[model samples]
Target chain A: MTEQLRESLSALMDDEATELELHRVLGELESDAALRQTWVRYQLARSAMGGQPVSHARLDISRSVSAAIAAEAGAETSRSSLRERWVRPLASLAVAASVTAVVVLGGQQLYQAGSLEGQSAPVAASGVSAVGFVNSLGAVPMRASYGAQAVPQLEPAARTAYRELARQRMYQYMQEHAEHAALNSPQGLIPFARVPQIEE
Target chain B: MKCVARQLASSVVCGLLFWAGGVAAQGPVCSEADAEALQWLARTVKSRSEVAYQGVVTLQRGDDMQVVQVARSLADGYSSEHLTRLTGQGAQVVRPHHPLNCTHPGEQLLTLGDRVEAGDCGLARYYRFEVGPGERIAGRQSVKLEIQPRDMYRYGFLLELDQDTALMLRASTLGRGGKILERFQFADLSYDEPLEPRSGMDTVHPAAHPHPDDPTAGARLSVPWIVSWLPNGFTATDAADPEGPRRTYTDGLAVFSVFLEQLPRELRPGEGLARLGSSLSYTRGMHLADQPVLVTVIGEVPVNTARMVADSIRVAR
Candidate 1:
């Protein structure tokens, strides 16, 4: 955005804009997409500063998220070329978070669909197989291959990832049981040994 | 013995005998050996809470092994343990061991003195406790306390308790036919049998911990999920006052937890099972009180035993 139009946005946010400045901001907002985006940011920042929520409107996060994904994709491509790519934990976490989020949301949807009148869980609408999602998330442990469901042409790495997720889920139940056991068992802290060393 | 050991926290031994044997309105008689084992169990229970120690423990299941570093501390009326997994996953956690200042379950019974008859420690009907010479573990001499189950419903235990403090140095869960199910023993320990007091010890000291009959402790509330069946001798722990989604019970020597949780979505699987070491967890998803709920029975019991417990859960009407 140009300096003149940017100043108009600032003036408009402060509500100190003259009729000319108001018109300029409004006129520029129509032709300049960047200026409109800036105006939203300005209003958000102003509203937040004043301790007032602008509106309960969902903020636009797609652009930033897409930018982050694009940047990560590049990093992933380059990292795969190297012998060691252990450093970028945050980058890997983003990918894992995205994967788990999809799994959780998809599982919820599939489960909810199956839950109606106690029907069987259909395949996830996201096209992931229902095999692991239905079986693994149930109260019991089952022989499941979540990665195979993720990619029918399974890579060994995918199998490992699925195993990791299953292990994480299993630990959750184990930890809950361990906490109770620790309280009443004759061996106080010893029961806690059963608890896995992983944080959810 | 664990129930008696737990009873040492507060409930009367004679009172327990009344329930165990149900012989008469008067407390039933417990054998002299039963009473001595109860005393040993009481000491063993307290030692784990009041005594502070740091050590590395090795746990072995049928084919799996885990090593953990544990530091136990008694401070601020609260004893706590900091455990770090030395083997896989590097999981670390700190949990409250037990409250020293808070009324321990058996502290009141200890004050009962002569009432704790070497004759009737009151747990004999369910378990036969034999205190025998223990082999040394982690450079400390121990006394072996074998709790043999009176029936096939529950498993037995062989515990190597620290001779002086009664801290359990090694413990093994005995399966059917005396099979070794799981064993957890200290690989090495930073030893000091006598507990040292730290600051926070200066609290409003109660002359005695709350007794089982303490009116203010309130009557036992019914847990939400009704367990229609439990292993032969299992009863809700006297000190268990949990007002949450889970409740634990003990046959004294063996403990199991009943967890009731609402599922956000129903799972397609019918009965789910998980096993680690001696612990078996059985999860069954069923609607209760017009809500989707998962009833899980997790215990150091046989898979079939846990499955029966899980099957027996009903929504308390």
Candidate 2:
């Protein structure tokens, strides 16, 4: 890990960083022992005044519960994949990783959905469109958000449609990335410019 | 009595010696087999990123299937790509650049190198590697390297890397049953040379309109909603919580939007789920933990994933 990362972890220990900084550190460091120990120590220090122990067990429970919910929600979203029951748990696991990742999400959603009330006034007054960009491996470049008007109400019918749409889109997006990664993989003989046509 | 005590003490010393030796052997060390696999995996991933290559890949979703022919050229932190469907659409092509998504020009994107480290023992922190039985894929022999999760928070991955180049030829998402939830299989592939710099630039040109001004851009948003919990590795990459309209939260892997438009008090929308093409959305109504609350989760993950997220939405007082 870079010194900057270690320093950030230290800042987290001291509660000197913003929520986003903490999230970034957690995202990359969650899998690292040295980093995780440092984080646990920070939590203890932060909660020391209250004499509360770091609740790793509680955190794990929350993660599992959240993942389960996400997977069930995904089940109702996709169509034409009835036989693919095996994907449910895996989907849940992916979603579980986002459990402790709230602050950034909470803030971003507030911003994206224009729920920040007074916050949007200045930006809107400045004539800024709240467009989102999802960065992927270079080449697809940038695909803009569907625009502000695209945010439809969560009506019963609309909600159903939205769920379906989300699953299909995600699968396609991930598949596309995997394809690109595989195509550029260092093996076999086909050149990058001449990948054979794939059929659906 | 003294002779008996001496014999007992000698036995205790022998036990201590054995215990120390066991502990020493247990200390962390990379086995030769693990070293070979990791070395090959690291070299393969690095080389793949910097090369021009092509392949035919089969993507399986549940029971549905799609085959794509792909071409990619990597040069100078950029990638040029073209994807054609042999069975469906004429050819849907994409020439993506390194750092794949750029909302604003000149914004530096994080690379794979920045996210994951290299080395035989390095990845052990994130994953536990286990070698499994060999399987033939895409007309070639392959070995399965199962990347099991060290924690329950993330999914485990089963990879079939080519025996020759160590290139990952096929991969699957594995869950509770050792079941394959989703998979991508390469029919054929090859990288001719190490990647070059100019490759990424060729396909990426800045958008004509970096920022667009529109009348509807400044839509009003309602709020007081909250999410009870979020996973560990996720962080909001950006926010649009301003007054112009709704709010959106996204992790690199998932995105959720919250629209807080005040509905007519008479509208008591029930929880509903739907699919539109590839996306999924869920809607639920309630009085915010304190105020009236209506929550909706829309994303490209499993339905359970969305529902859990939706349920977690409680209005902050």
Candidate 3:
């Protein structure tokens, strides 16, 4: 039976297996470690044949993703039921109010960093753990500056001005790089897409 | 019994053939044909300036995506390009066409043939080009060209060029472990379209042109600042800028610029790194000639590479 199941799994890898064989292979895959190993080997082999790079170690995140979804669902139900009782009769009004609230709150936070922190602090204080948000978002890891001998302290206003100056200079450099790349790169106008869309 | 034996024999044969095929497609094999591919790529570069086209392209970095509409035209060896953001705030930028003679020396080398040899040689040393399977993109058949970097200093690229026009349809920057750092692909494209006259397109024109008579023009200075180290195959391309004395370097593919500028007295010195899309900027504060100057290295390079370059700056004797 194991030999038959392995043959079926290999056939499924080739996409030549019948539906019955696929079902049989999937059913055995859960309890059979040897069968799972065979399935992985078959996948690796297929990728190799396609001339694609394959990662040796695989990290499956499906279980964690499912857990996150379940947690979100639970949170949503517990929070929304109370609101639903009061808001169901005035759905349109409530939606309009919520939309206005979001826009006003979002705009205010965009201009004020202190308010942004205050907004996030409640979530952190509530024990929801903002670290999961960062992980789920797959944010780029920040790199620390290398070879920093000393950091000079400055007044808050001066620090903000300095940061603004640095940002402007960086933007200038980025624009110059993009313009030069546009003229030089063999890839044609593709380089132009790299230019940041500076909003007025 | 006979039928079972026949089925087993066929399955065994199929598996053997599949395994053999896998073994054959291992890695890029260098050959004389690669030279031809290089020449073809060079021709494509030249053709970009001479040909006119319009396309809608999507740029993807991490989870962010932006769509841009681009139009290009070439007249009398001068190329003009207009790019508009299809998404976001609908920002439009129009770059006026400047004659080839008015362009900087580095830009000239790229357009002219002198740098082609250097570029080709550098390419040969630093990258391996492999021809991959053909696919259809934006309703056009494209051939995949895989450019694997010889070292970690530079990222690899997988480009799909239109088989007929040699125009690039899709390009992806591959990072360590073959992860795609960024991707640019044409959603739709048209080649050799009639050049449209600049009209009421809500365009943002540059305030002033860098004319030959301008003081900044032809002001290539021999700056005292120098980078102690650079990635392999990278060479300084342009002469130092007169304004900031910025230095630009390229490895025939990736490019980076170094800027040394004076900071305000009241401002405190800080070192930091930032990334926007695939481009990164690393800034460090240092004392140059008794004045506080910030050394910034900016490029579409890996963050560590940018930091390394920023840290490697020193005053030349």
Candidate 4:
């Protein structure tokens, strides 16, 4: 590029030029034969000074990126019919959101169920054990702690994410069950501790 | 010419992919025969839960004696007489209507929502279910089912269900490595028979007196040594009166009874272990400043299991 043109482009890159100054510089460089020649010369001079080979790679990258963007823009324009233009993409977004929602919702149920694995089975031991209550104490070995430690082995993030979702669902289910039971039970009210609020 | 051929080839491939995805998503449709078998199984299972059956269940720890008389009928869900070494010490709970006592804040019992309302899939909280082979139990064909623990936080269950009623004829708890921890079986079990009104009826009565008012109610409520950890499926299933004296924790499958009674002011730490038939018990003494705490954990698991459970008992302020 010419010295003036190169200087202006450098200023533009540095954000030192006004928008108009940039537009004018870029506009002039776009069509200016001498400016183009000078710009090429400057790049060649810089690379040569560093003992680097002239790179066609950078040129290829800019061309490819611009080409991809142009293709995407064309596709976007063609998607214009009522069904093709607006509805399809809109429907696609809805479907994506719905799928995500389903996963999160299902995950919530699984997590809630898993967390309560500790609590719900209270009846299994207390109420259901009517058939048999084992009081055998020493046959097993030291695996209790081994079991406790296993909770941490879960992928921490995934476990937490699922656990939170599960807990919320369990609370909702429990609330619904309790409400329904109360309505049907003659006692007027089923007494149990309020489901404790989850701390944020 | 090239573009047309490429389009045709791509369309064929896309069509095949869509066909496969559709097939994968469709669940197997249950035929009439399959549905009949399932219905029979459900009836059999419900009978086990609702019909009156009497049996002597021999519970063995590594080598302890914990036996009980269990009788249930659909009219009354379940009633049991927990056998104890002490002539009349074993505790009994009856659920003529609901198996759980809704009046108490026991575990998730507080969530006794409308029985009609469907609860979310809460099984994953405590179990990992695995489809098992079909087997035979009580002279009837049955399905071998496993309720595995997805995490170590809970114990696993291996159950044999009578094919006709889906009633669990046999069930056992397993450890982290899939070792059988305890088993509940029918020395003699039957279904649909009417239970004598006076035979085991009083045994199912709710503790006549509020547990709080009775001095013995708090007998094992506190222990000096607190449990450092509790597995995922375990919780304080029942707490008589933490302030009274005795408390208990259970994992729906195992029970750990804690006795927080007075000990010598200067008692030292030691392992107090006991085995009776299939039951195991552990006792230890600890102190909070000047007060001494004696804690005992009794269950069908190993001594270490009781110890670990006892070690996790802490006095919640």
Q: Which stretches of model 1 miss by more than 4 angstroms? A: A1-132, A135-170, A198-200, B1-32, B75-78, B96-98, B103-120, B193-224, B237-244, B262-269, B287-292
Against the true structure, what is model 2's DockQ? 0.05
Better of 3 and 4 by TM-score: 3
lDDT (10s digit) by residue, model 1, range B77-127: 666666666777645665543456333322332222244553333456667
Tens digit of lDDT per residue, candidate 4, span A82-194? Answer: 74765655544443343223222322232224332132200111111111112221111223544533222322322232223223333332322222222221111111111
CA lDDT, candidate 1, residue B52: 77
lDDT tens readout by residue for model 3, B266-316: 122334455666676766544455455667777767654564576566667
Q: What fraction of correct interface contacts does each candidate retain?
A: 0.15, 0.06, 0.12, 0.00
Q: Sort candidate 3 into its docking category.
A: incorrect
Which ten contiguous residues of candidate 3 chain B have the minimum total lDDT?
Answer: B207-216
lDDT of each: 0.54, 0.41, 0.53, 0.38
The digit string of per-residue lDDT tens for model 2 on A1-200 reads 55456555544433444445555665656467655443432332122112211213223322343454455567646834655466755554444334333322322233333332222200100110111111111111112343322222212223333234333333333332232222222322221112223223
CAPRI docking class of candidate 4: incorrect
Worst 10 residues of 1 chain B by lDDT: B201-210
Q: How many collisions between residues are there in candidate 2? A: 102
The CAPRI class of candidate 1 is incorrect
The candidates' DockQ values read 0.06, 0.05, 0.06, 0.01
Q: Candidate 3, which segments miss by more than 4 Å at Cα?
A: A1-169, A197-200, B1-30, B98-120, B195-203, B206-223, B266-270
TM-score of chain B of each: 0.71, 0.55, 0.74, 0.57
TM (chain A) per model: 0.26, 0.26, 0.27, 0.22
Using lDDT as the measure, the top candidate is 1
Q: Write the per-residue lDDT of candidate 2 for residues B123-179, one digit (tens) a residue.
A: 343356777656887766787777665433334567787676555678675654466
